[model samples]
Target: MTKWSTIASSLSPDKMFLMKQAMEQLDTRYDEQESMVWGEEGQHDTRESAHYALGLLLRGSLEDVQMASGIIDRVLEMQLTQQGEIYEGTFRASPEQQAPPSGYTAWGTFSPGYGYAQQDALTEVYRRFAQYAQLEEQTQYKEQFGRAADEVFPRVWESFDPNWREFIACTFAVILENFEDRLSIKQVARMDKAMQRAVSTSLERYVSQSIPTNTNIELMHLFIAHYYGHRYEQIDWIQHAERGAMALLDDYRELHSFAEFNSSTYYGVDLTVLGMWRVYGRSVSFRNIGLQLEHGLWEDIAAFYSPAMENICGPFARSYENEITSHSSIGVLLYLALGESKRHLTSINCETSHDLLIALFGVDVPEAALQQLREQQGERFAVRQFKELCERDLPGHNRHVCTATAWLSPQLMIGGLTGSHNTNGQMHHATAHWLDEQGRRYSMRMVRREVGQSWNTHLRGMTFNVETEVSRLDITAHLEAAVPIELVFELEGAALHEIQITADRWQLPGLTVQVDAQAPQPQVIQQGGRAEIVYAVEHRDRIWNQMHFRLYFL
Candidate 1:
């Protein structure tokens, strides 16, 4: 028998029984209440198909392929009608029942959210499949892609739902454009620019009005419209999307905007960051026009499923600690980038709100957190976000993670460095790197602490920033504190000398200067003058306020 089979058999007599049970559930093919959330909009089966499909891609088991392929088949089979309109909403109900607007579908399962659609769900199916098809068999892969190129695009073109229709059509258009490029090359047929404009215009109108968006329905259309607008030089469409996206970020607060909420952070702050990402950080189209939104959108989409990443994708997402709510972590990350965190944000399952604060944009494990992930990963998937972190960046910046984009920071990446516990489960997410000015090196250690509570409720009250140069640095703290214990900073180096400290009168009481190996004592100095050493106590959580420093030659 194979190692997996032998191992399964040895580990538990019930392992085979469990697999059998899963197979039985597969046979029954009953969707859970949770699954219904996705399927209700004709989008469930496709996304599940995508999920299983991704698992299959990683493990590459034939059973996985068949399972994923069959799910995709079921979704395709349950088409609203061959007429390419009127879709199922998980219950297998007919069009007549959906039309009355009972204000509830499934007796209360769904809010008739984002309305109904036919092509949008299937287009998402196409999106997931396309990502999977790369590692898939070229023949069958090409065949499924061929269906998307041929049958799907035409149906998308005919659809009535604005968001899903536009999105699916755009997806199909992108495929056609790509197919022409990859399989057969001829002078590309020009798209109907007016039709494209219509797509983005509708979507932009929806977001501009702060109308319901971020569902399978709205996201699909929005994805298509924004992506293709840029592709075909549709400036007005881009401008329109930009304006609406900006409003969502600048004006909308989760506490104030009841509409700005979702099951996953991906739809809320994540998407907010995404829209912001597309605008400011410049997330470009990886493939077809619409998919720029998918990757960026999906990045936000999957934040809450960190638990799933634990259960499903393994260590790639294991870098997150148990204390941080996925939503909270997402909120903090966004605040680090956006300058404020939205309130009434829901907590992610298997996460607490405290964990969120520690998960800022540039935060990392401090030797203690890593051990926990390893123990968990060791038990399950042997996951390694370290490899991921080194390649991308810690805490997923404007780029997400290090590996997903580029190595973050002037700090050389943790090349080939992995995490394991030393008798105790203490973990560290940092590497020893030289902080230098033309090869002069000083060690910089980043640590995370959540010791004090801020009187201010805004997350801006809880955040701080520190930057290091050759011999000088600036520290900024955001707080509305009576006595914010600002983090104390100093250079305990051998080559360091003549480190002087100074601060404004208001900040003077918070200062205690301790030069190399000196005592931690308060010092008085004129504002704007250099100090031999600087000891500072920043009150917890504030933003955009800084203590300046001017270094002198020894």
Candidate 2:
């Protein structure tokens, strides 16, 4: 029951400035006629409109609140109201979108049921606006907010996707804890039943399996749910969450890195959820653990962040955008914590609204992390980190079956997972990043091309070992099948003069590559600013089973 006024006043100067800037950015995106913001895809985005409304509500000015009310009303109208449909109670991604096909699993489209965790932000916006309406004695807005919550609450338990269940449940718990008083008695009863079902299903799933620790952000949401279950005296829910939390903590304690390591987008999610626990956990142990883990994560970010490049040097486990200078959620978080000096490096745009949680709760980045972020220029160094993956060795048991490595240096960063062979499409395996002679940054990552597939995939049976100097990266790849395969190096942000290829080796402005396989010269395919340096491992119409390459970035 914290008030917006209290939260606003409690924000540090840096966060306060960031919040105002984020609000301004969101406000500029608002389309007055449509009562929503046009997204990057040039459509009226329901989720982004809700995020914009939330930022406006947080701003709490007279005109800002009025604009927020309009957006909220429009977004609520976008929710599917047809009973008995697959997406009956869920919101649409866009104004004219329909429910997805019966077998659809892609969550990024304008489909009704694929909003995933992004839709959870709408529930938070409803709760916060409801609270504001009650405080300001705005009766119409209060009723509107209450009805919006009622419309969405029953659907929280409807998602069977394990990847997003905890995220939805965590937001549901927050709504129940904060906005339950505003709901009608019938609505509250329905919500309570839905929550029971949700918790029971979660408990049942984890009974025979270990909790997932690889996706770092959702792991934190599970911990947040555990805290709420303890607060509500739900024994099973509390135990399940506690088990997951301890397992995750123990995993981090072992290697001091998350399985989803060094992500620009998800790192913000990780930090936000951790901040939720740190600020609002019911128990001292929960609060302390949150603080400890948050500090450790900040340290890791600082260690890999290159001030000169203005980006986190990666071997990223998951990444939405390769360049940090683009519109990114992580850049907003960094700007808030690191202050004005980071403004030029930060890309503050509509996506900055993603930092609403951090703005409301506040951030506490450690001084040690801050010092490294501020001073880690012109000093040469190297870093190697190992992360454990959860995989099954036998039925109903999980072990550290795969390990991922990330090696970082002052000028270049390279590394990847040892046993990952499939393409989830986000794994940056065998990745390298360096600054060219003209100080322009470039990224090179290995991708596999199958026989008939036009799109490149991340699938590869490969492993890397970094030498002592960290400037040299050794890669060994094998082919499981006899299909002709080509290991392509996709280079982005390079110009014509920045690369050269010879019969024996390849040279980039910042790194050199040498292959030990008896293959022809590398083929260069250029598409605008991006190029793919393709190395085919086929000889005499038969693909080789194994090949080796070395990258020297010194």
Q: Per-residue lDDT tens digits of candidate 1, residues 1-554? A: 32222223343222233233323333343344322213234444332332233223222345544453444334333223222122222112212122211212221222222222223344446546756666553234645654544343322223223333333243233333323332222212322333353464455335432123433344434445456666677776666555544443332332222121222322333333233233322224312222344243333223212221121121112232212234333433332222222222223332221221122112222233323322332111111221111111112211111111112123221111122111111111221122234433332221122223321111112232323233222333332332233333212223343334434211112122222321224343222322122333432342323333222111
The candidate scoring highest on TM-score is 2
- Score each candidate by Cα lDDT: 0.30, 0.59
Residue 98 shift from truth in candidate 2, angstroms:
4.5
Residue 68 lDDT, candidate 2, scale 0-100: 64
Candidate 1 TM-score to native: 0.27
Residue 87 local lDDT, model 2: 39
Report lDDT (Cα) of residue 412, candidate 2.
Answer: 69
Where model 1 places Cα greater than 4 Å from the true spot, the runs are: 1-44, 58-70, 73-211, 214-221, 228-240, 253-554
Q: What is the TM-score of each candidate against the true structure?
A: 0.27, 0.71
RMSD of each: 22.5, 12.7
Error of 1 at 514 (Å): 51
